[model samples]
Target: MSFTVAIVGRPNVGKSTLFNRLVGKKLALVDDTPGVTRDRRPGDAKLIDLKFTIIDTAGLEEAGPETLEGRMRAQTEAAVDDADLTLFVVDAKFGLTPLDKTFGELLRRSGKPVVLVANKSEARGSDAGFYDAYTLGLGEPVPISAEHGQGMIDLRDAIVEALGEERAFPEADDEAETNIDVRDSDFAGDADEEAEPEYDETKPLRVAIIGRPNAGKSTLINRFLGEDRLLTGPEAGITRDSISVEWEWRDRTIKMFDTAGMRKKARVQEKLEKLSVADALRSIRFAETVVIVFDATIPFEKQDLQLVDLVLREGRAAVLAFNKWDLVEDTQAVLADLREKTERLLPQARGLRAVPISGQTGYGLDKLMQSIIDTDKVWNKRISTARLNRWLDGVQTQHPPPAVSGRRLKLKYMTQVKARPPAFMVSCTRPDALPESYIRYLINGLRADFDIPGVPIRMHFKAGENPFEGRKKKR
Candidate 1:
């Protein structure tokens, strides 16, 4: 098993910055604003030859149970509990604050292996703060600049030493331990007609649940886990960051993400809300399958439709679900209306899977889980070159391209470039001149012919180049 490290510290200590630096990607949003990271974001970090899973958590803060800061602290604590080691970061430029001492004491009580990190050490006079960090009693602070990428080697060594020999050499054991338990759902539903999914014990399927404010996204996740793992209340926008949990459904390993409830652009005035929306979008992009949850009573709002469109544009498979089903009096009417709206409003994602569920009562939770597994199957669907080309022939013959500038556009060849949205590349003359309508026609044809549904289809048109002419330079 890879070593798990959680970066924890007081607000604005550059923990997110350091996380972005270590992951070698802008996975987490970094800003001068304190308490920006509300959820625990996990990423695979690489330091030269060292590889391990790293979690970027919200800043440790003191607040009452009802306050937002208090909830953020709860999420961070959960990350610390799950981690094998913790990187206790402190702001070297600002020196140690009262809050830093509190966090240090908290980490001490936890008794987890910790590597003290003093961030912003590249600044002038920052050495004083680095020295002050020693008082925390964790160890000699590894001073480094998370923004400027300085002193990483020292930080790497510190982490390696903290991990020790057992974790560093994982290959020593013939079988790696998997924490996920394989169990079947209580409901007895037949698996989809598609080939039995090849379950990979190593990688968990990444699933994201997204919706507008107060849509019960967190509630749904909590219900699926059979516990109140995620904090939920009657308040809208309680969840401000994308928090993920390792889950198992029907013996399948799944990494489920409960994202911040997205409000319309006009309503998002505060800087924090905008950050939350961005975090939710990132969760959708990273997820293998996204479940667009909706409150059944008021489903299909403008924002909900927009979220569905965004997911399709991102080339991710989606499952539409209506939460609070127990509250709906006329269930049949609501379901029918939703089906009509789904077809009329979101034609791009035709044949989208929909499930009615009650997050509060746990009704239809099994169906929702089944849809997620099925949607993921379709999302990763791949068609062979031979089958793709054969279908392309029939599609072109059925609806030939219209003449452009008094010349017919010659379609030469077609092949799938990749899957996970199943991208295709078509080689033909005057590819740029092809109309959007024609592209959609080909996309829909490919979708229907391949029995691919509920997932986005990507088609790229390329102008066919003459092989002989390219071989010899034109004189």
Candidate 2:
């Protein structure tokens, strides 16, 4: 097993910054605001030759178990228990506070090996705070500036000392056994006229659950995991960072991302919320499939429609999950009404799959999962060049391209350029003269004919060159 390390500290002590520094990527959100990270996020980190799993946790705080802060503390404690080593971080620029000392004692009592990390040591007048760290009884502090890439060598040495060299750097035979099996077909083929790659079942399917605040996104993900893996409550915007969890569904590896709820732009006045929303958008961009959760009682709000449009524009497969089905008295009528609204308001994503589910009671989750799988297949669907040309012939015959400047436009050929949000390229005369209405008609025809619905389709037209003019005539 890989060695696991957890970064734990009170709020705003640069714990996230330290995590980003160690991982060499900005996986964790860092801001001046306190308590920005509520969920425990794990990433594969490599410090020079030492490779291990690192978890970034919320800043520890003292609060009642019922409050949000207390729940965040519980998450931090769970991370500490799960890790083999804990890096207790402190702000060296401003000495240790009483809360930090209390958590330091708690970490000591937990019996896990602790590595004291004094962040922001590059700043002037931080030596006193670094010296004060010794009073907490956590051993010598490793002074490092996480933001400026300073003292990482000392930090690596400290970690090796804490976990022992054997555990930090395992035998080569032990490390070689962890290689994942990836087939040649798993990678993309040639650049021009490339065949669609087969979906690698061995790889995990990335699905992101996103919606407005308090839309039961976390609850739905927790139900899928069959545990309280994500922090959930009645409060809105409880989750600040997009937390990803991996699990098996029907022997298939699946990774689910629970993102911070996005709100209207006008109401997002705080910089922290804006950062959270941007993170959520990044999740959508990276995800192969997005499950847009909605409150069953308040279905299809204005922001919800806008989010749907955004997802379609991003060229990702989407599924509408109407959560909280148990609250509805008239299930059939409400579902029918929801279907109608989805059709009327979101015509761009025609035939989008909508499933009603109750995150609390675990209703319709199976259907939702099945829908996700089906949408993913459609997103990766590819068509052959010959088949595309045949379909193009039939489509153009029925409804020919309209005339522009008294000359009829001719569509000579068409072929699929790529999939995963199916895109097509068409060769025709005067490509720019084709009206938007005709392009929409052809796109609709392709969607209906190919059975690729709801997912975004891209089509581009190019002017075809005359063969006779380019070469000498046979006569």
Candidate 3:
């Protein structure tokens, strides 16, 4: 149920720059050279409240008409095929070129939604070229300077209208989705029921490694798999699609996936890039706990951060894996900085555990595996109501739900609703007023006290008194 926008234009049109601006990362290797981006990089593209997947494509080129460049262009064309909207970028400073015209014609012929973007239009002399964008027939071109961050508001409105998303950034503001299990010992009565299923400790928890291209995602996976199953090098981007492998660790069947590297949007110009990143996301959905890998050299680039955000948003428990730990100097300083940045940069999924390891040298692999095991435990944890209600009572007593419309909403009780990305349910007078910050506090508390680390936790607030008040509600 995700929407998509494909960024297509000739090379060196700042398509990757615009992609980095929207996805908030320098994921695409930017150079003065044309066609620097060969692979298609897709990220969870967001413009304020407009949430959609964005594909940063390689620049179209005039190759031997059937060579690699030609085939690459063909891939770019295919990206346009799947997009709900296309961002047609042009270099306003450089003016329109013949290649631009050719692709422009192809885009128009596709008959899909298109938004013409005249990037690098901040220079005084760029106006004439920006004006020429009108001739492309993609509609009134929005002049934007991706590097300097100009015309964003106008671009925001345009995207909102084009994608049909909200005008404001989404509410990171929903009530918790946790429901406590307060059923009596025999509440879940079943004619065919036997003893409760024994919690299997021997099962190797399924885990995944996901991140933008060149963020050391494959490196991390290699360390866990204990071999170089996937190729790794200094190349800016190497992964092409999701690769899954199975291994046993301490009698646990740990399945790991090394996924295609995702670049920020504009860099993803080819059809192959789109297919690659999509495959990685699909892997995350199947993983119980996904390890979002980050390059130790440049941790938390906008695209890498967004990938982590996407995993949690997709309802998967996530752990932060800082790869290439061996190359980093002053390890403690880096960890401290990472902790600070994660807390500030990713406030939505708070209390996420971060472990540093060198995927190449195998440093800290043991700790990483332990952390994964611990996080998986949290992901599958089901909190007992007696303990939960007690915690909720104390939390409410300390900091009651804030008043809404001069009517104080009372949160009567809470219980663990489910497990596997553990969910909690809070019965309250007005569930609407439960602040996001408060719910986060409860999750942090649960993680710390109950040893639930690294995975995502959900807490839900239901209106009215406890669902099981007085006579127990049916389990």
Candidate 2 lDDT over residue span 87-200, tens digit each: 999999999999989999998888789999999999999999999999989899999999999988998999999999888887767657576743222124414453545665
Could you tell which candidate, 1 or 3, scores higher by lDDT? 1
**Residues 288-394 of candidate 1: C-alpha lDDT, one tens digit per residue:** 88999988999899999999999999888899999999999988988899899888999997889999999999999899888888787776666666777788888
TM-score of each: 0.74, 0.93, 0.55
Superior by lDDT: candidate 2 or candidate 3: 2
Ranking, lDDT, top scorer first: 2, 1, 3
Top TM-score prediction, candidate number: 2
Ranking by TM-score: 2, 1, 3
Query: Which runs in model 1 stand beyond 4 Å of their true positions?
Result: 48-50, 157-204, 226-235, 238-245, 266-279, 376-453, 456-475
Task: Encode model 3's per-residue lDDT on 62-174: one tens digit a residue.
Answer: 78644657656766776788788898999899999988888888888988878889899998799999989999887899989999999988887776666564422344434
lDDT of 1 at 152: 92
The model with the greatest lDDT is 2
lDDT per prediction? 0.84, 0.89, 0.75
For candidate 1, list the clashing residue pairs, or say none.
none
Runs off by more than 4 Å, candidate 3: 1-199, 465-475
